[model samples]
Target: MLRGSAETEAKLRFQQASGPIMAKGVEDTAFYTYQRFIACNEVGGDPDRFGVSVDSFHAYNAHKQLEWPVAMLATSTHDTKRSEDVRARLAVLSEMPDAWTRAVQRWSEMSQTYRKPSVDRSIEYHIYQNLVGAWPIDAERLQRYLEKAMREAKVFSSWTRVDEAYESAVQDFGKGLLTDQRFTADLSAFVDSINRAGEENALAQKLLALTSPGVPDIYQGTETYDYSLTDPDNRRPVDHAAHAALLDEAAKADRKTILNRWNSGLPKLWLVVQALRTRQEFPECFDDRATYEPLPSHGERLITFVRGSKASKKRVLVIATRLRRSGVTDTVVALPEGEWRDALGQRAKVQGTVKLDGLCAGLPVALLTSS
Candidate 1:
């Protein structure tokens, strides 16, 4: 071969051999993806956004209506870093940074002994937080989860170039965490403490996704509490029987009973069923050219909007909340003058501007339809 051809071929071979290094190059992609707000790092989402404000959210939806009109509004996907519930729990940290900082410090100290000497403290700290948020509370499940998490994190080890020594250390850490009763107890208590707020955030997100100006989707078994981690764990077999039973129960449930099941995440299912039923019954209300009027709310924590069709003269009012455990007392959303009835339940007429405190009493969301 010519001298130049020999050198070029050598370089090409070197590049081919360096494929593993090329793969490792994207390891920091996780950091670049979620450095702003970890919540937006999910598949198909812009990771640079810190968080979506109510106005920005409405604006985005409006733009979509004008442009795409059929965009997917989703909370969780198969490849999400953490499940939607975990992201919801993490979002709560924004409201309580002090509490989160303190909790992280306490959990790190509590689980310090479980960390392998070879493991970095920073990575260990992150692992504990994610585990607390998405932990399945099962030894085997958590073990598989930690292994995958540590590998994907690529801090101490990676899939392309496995560091058996470090990987073994991580496995050892997981085993120790499971065996240590004190560690397990503290972790469970911490998770339980944050889980209630997580539930609230989850419900609020569900309501927003379903009522927004796009087609809402419900992943399999998501109607119930899906506190899954990621991948195969998130892809666990769903109990359709139980879901069918819950749907049956939700169908028979009165508004009050359904509201009481909000914590169980059944109310979200109920909201989905009711909203889709309305959309199916009156497809014209969801037309791209239909009017979308965002109702003015008294507080930043509440988002209210109305969907309507001038041609068909149909309207649907949606009210959903945000933040953790926020009260709706004294908060009001302005509406078009008409008779709007709670489509999810009783047909009590709502007229003019309505006070959310009375309307959304003990409910995570409200769906009102025009008569």
Candidate 2:
């Protein structure tokens, strides 16, 4: 069975790489073929399966107004090169181009002291400096960060065969950065800026993708902020215990207010789960046949779309905000007259047009679903 399976996989890979004729002839033909075979053979579906490219999926969503129900949209994967947090932070750079450029220039200037070193040495120094400078330093946080860095360093050192000197330097740098309070604050600010930018970008992408025509798939642990660097970090075990503790604390206290005021990420996870549950319950409303009418907002921060069956008498309008830095209050959302529910807050009312000032209020995503 193993031999046969291997042979089948090899054949499928060959077919996939042969030419566009075999891979792109039909919508997801290549992928479906592999999935069907895996199912028949009782093999678990490949996590690395090439279901569809992001570009192709987005294009399909744009073109097919009636086919939203069948398509799935996703952003992150175990095989992805960067962590979602990193991507989100990077996305902020696009919004604050000058800030990003300035930050990079600062990093470059700081790194100039070691520029003449060999490639391996330079990379080692840079990684060490980044880890040391960026790690948060509360006792518990420091321990966690150190353990993660040490584990990753071991893996990286082994994989890259970095010289003993470089490894020692990285370790020493980390130790110094951890012990020195002065450097910690400066480094923390820089790291925080990168993280904030990344989070903003990620949130924007999520809001846009979720409200778009296709079904959005949430990767594990993406609901809250994830700041891992590469594969193992991205795939780190979900800390259910910590999450439970957080939930317990929230239940005992006014967690929502704290989260909202501090921009704490706990609410984002809730929002994602709620959105998914809502989407699942109202699958008919998001069927591929539904039209996608993008509403114009005064700023790029707002994105609105309406989805409904052409044959059905009812339609659902979804308005989401991509704003991260600014607060929106009593903002008006224009929709065809009827009643609507605030999917994020469960606030409901009847009206053709509604005001949504504090609804989005720094939240990464907000949904207004009409019945």
Candidate 3:
């Protein structure tokens, strides 16, 4: 009757019923179960999309230039479920799901005694991974975070109707398990392994955000390692004095050495400052209409590309890796015909064919300018 409605009352009834259905149809169409990847679960992003190929990324950039040139390139936001670094760490697990499953089992066995009867195994797995990715977390902080997560999950507790008993049980589990000496030690060791590989992923993405075609936004205190969770954790105060002191120290040192050490997120901060400086100095190179050229790479791991007007003589070549721990073993990227100086590094030059093993001796990615 509503579908065939021609009468005024029938048409009005159909409109009222269909409005919410249509609206919810779009809303519910987003990534649901696929959010397990988590890295792609950002606002307006499809979590089901595993990873973008280098070729697709270039195509996306080209489209961005033609259409949404003023898009904001971002990784973290106050409303994000997990911090960028946490997602970066978890992204590695996608490539090693079997290992992740085994680790989850081991962790569950290691901490099962502390869990309350109400605790769900799936939620436990989720909590364990979040803890590992966001390690160095103090007990008090972790408990508060867990409490919030529990309420948000609304399985045992909820924000509106307080399930005090269930909330307390979850808190007890966090307090008991997270505080155990042996558990902490094992957790730290596990986090160290993930960080070893995760840091490489972090660096690659950071470089892309800075050099890719779009206006990049650096959230507060994000220049450093941001392994933060949602809300209060991500919104924590920044020690500007400390960061300023680090920036001063970095200014005196060469970019290459800073990147090699990558100690205390100095390398990331340096990259930001250098890239922003370049953008500020050469607006034409990053113009909304600038041509995006994807450079060919002989290596399977490298993603190389150039951006800017070829006639302008001011161009930027960006080269980043896709994998972690692979390092520079037998990797080579084809370069444009000209002498290019490292824009981010101190003193590195390359022409024609560039060898990653030689160029990035200790670094994971590099940005270069034609000389």
**Cand. 1 Cα-lDDT:** 0.71
Error of 2 at 150 (Å): 17
Tell me the tens digit of each residue's lDDT in model 3 across 1-371: 34443686777887899977643333222322233654665555566677777778888988987887778888777766677777777777776777677777777787877888887765576577678778888777777777676665555666788888877877777777777888888777777777757877777788888878888888887787788876778888889998898788667768556856664878777767777877776677777767788886444577888887645887788888766654457776677888888876645777877677666656677788873
Best by TM-score: 3
lDDT of 1 by residue, 116-141 (tens): 68866655655666666675457677
Error of 1 at 200 (Å): 2.2
Clashing residue pairs in candidate 3 (N, C-alpha, C atoms within 3 angstroms):
none
lDDT of 1 at 350: 76
Model 1 vs. true fold: TM: 0.85
How does each model score on lDDT? 0.71, 0.52, 0.73
Candidate 1 stretches greater than 4 Å from native: 1-37, 46-48
> All candidates' TM-scores?
0.85, 0.63, 0.87
